[model samples]
Target chain A: GAGVSQSPSNKVTEKGKDVELRCDPISGHTALYWYRQSLGQGLEFLIYFQGNSAPDKSGLPSDRFSAERTGGSVSTLTIQRTQQEDSAVYLCASSPRQYQETQYFGPGTRLLVL
Target chain B: GESVGLHLPTLSVQEGDNSIINCAYSNSASDYFIWYKQESGKGPQFIIDIRSNMDKRQGQRVTVLLNKTVKHLSLQIAATQPGDSAVYFCAETAPLNAGNMLTFGGGTRLMVKP
Candidate 1:
């Protein structure tokens, strides 16, 4: 079966620019999540989407960070006015359903804000 | 204010040897815990999970042990092989208004010597 997939495996941008990272969950997954990982650090939760409910933006660090999942399938994470501190690997994961413990992940999109 | 952390940042073991990775989490309210394996340039891949009600769970050559009393979690691999070499992370699910979000620990890098 096809696993989760992400686009633009690597991205380099200048500070103050905006970038979008894309994620495609498995065929039937109903839940998607985005996280950020700094070098040699743990993953920091960004946002989550389940079914048609409002996305969870609690983990988002600031208003500049936003995400959208359309048709309950694909998700895009956008960081506006990126800062050097925002340089990290953006990862996406998905589960078969809400509250499911196991999450399948995609190869992350590494973002470097210079 | 809750956080998850690992005692060791790196571990080296010979092939065929058993490996143990330890993690500590501060959120007692967490009910579900998971372990993930990630290689360079890749996102995390789920290994196994255990609920707070269970003290231990096993899958294939891997075992996850949780000690709620001490808020400790450990992943043990029996007869580990070179393929097991990677960064291992322990994550706990924190309840959110929208659902459960994972809080990950700083990963422990495992180097397997053939």
Candidate 2:
């Protein structure tokens, strides 16, 4: 079985540019989540999707950050205007259910804004 | 501080010695806890998890102890090795009604010396 995977393992862009990171969660998983990892920042919850219900957008960093999960499987996180402070690893995780289950993570996409 | 933090930012131990990493979470409603490990260039990997109902849970060689009385959680690694050198993070899920939001700790860097 293939584990969770993300495209463009690494990405680099200039400041003020737009960037999108993709995540493919495990098949049959009903819950998916996005998180960011920065130096000394630990892991910050970004957004979460469960089945086809409304997504939880509370953890999004700011207005510039947004994410959408289509078909309850693949998710795309977009940044309107990239900033140097946005340079970090974008991680995606999924689980069979959101009821006290463990989350399996993808390799993550490292984004660097210059 | 109102965030999850570690007593020590870093811990150094011999390859065969046991290791203990501590975390303090301020949220009294945090009941579900999980321990994750992140390598230098990889995404975080889930090691183990424990609910507030139980005070202890054990994995292959790792153990998680939750002290709800004091809002403290700790991860213990037995027979530590170089392979275990990485940043360990403690994450807690909010009480039942808060959805899937997880608050993560600052993390503790574990250095295993040969």
Candidate 3:
């Protein structure tokens, strides 16, 4: 079976620009999550979607960061007015269920805000 | 704010040797813990998980130990191989959260000497 996957493995963008990263979860996964990893730092929670429930956006760093999951499968993380501080690896993960389950991860999209 | 941290930033071990990575978390309220392995230019792949109720859990060649009293977590790999060399991260999640938005610890880079 195919694992989770993301598009545009690498992206270099100017500051103040907007970028959208896409994620395709594994088949039969009902929960998806987005995370950010800065150099020499831990992974930071961004947002997550569970089935048809309203996505949890509390982990998003700022209003400029937003994510949307369509049809309970694919998810897109959009960064508006990107800043140099937003430069990092954007990782996506998915789980078969919501609790007590393992999350499979994608290869990730590396975004560099220049 | 409470966060997870690794005691060592890097570890080097010979192939076929056992490897141990340690992590400390600040929040006692966290109920779920997970370990992930990430290679360069890749997302984190789940290794093992242990709930607050359990002290230890094992999967394949990996074992995860959790000590709630000291707020510590550790991942041990038996017969470490070159393929096991990667950054390992420990993540925590509280019970109240509806979605699986985990708080990750700074990763420990494992270098296997073949």
What i-RMS does each candidate reach, in Å? 1.4, 1.3, 1.2
List the pairs of residues colliding in candidate 2: none
TM of each candidate vs. truth:
0.96, 0.95, 0.94
Per-residue accuracy of model 1 over B1-114 as CA lDDT, tens digit each: 888999999999999999999999999888889999999889999999999989999999999999999999999999999999999999988554245678899999999999
lDDT of 3 by residue, A1-114 (tens): 589999889999999999999999998999999989998678888899999889989889999999999999999999999999999999999999987677888998999999
- CA lDDT, every prediction? 0.91, 0.89, 0.91
Cα displacement (angstroms), candidate 2, residue A105, comes to 1.3
List of chain B TM-scores, one per candidate: 0.96, 0.94, 0.96
Of the candidates shown, which would achieve the greatest DockQ relative to the real structure? 3
Ranking by TM-score: 1, 2, 3
Cα lDDT tens digits, model 1, A14-59, are: 9999999999999988889899999988899889999778898988
lDDT of 2 by residue, A12-35 (tens): 999999999999999999999999
Worst 10 residues of 3 chain A by lDDT: A98-107
Q: DockQ for every model, please.
A: 0.74, 0.69, 0.79
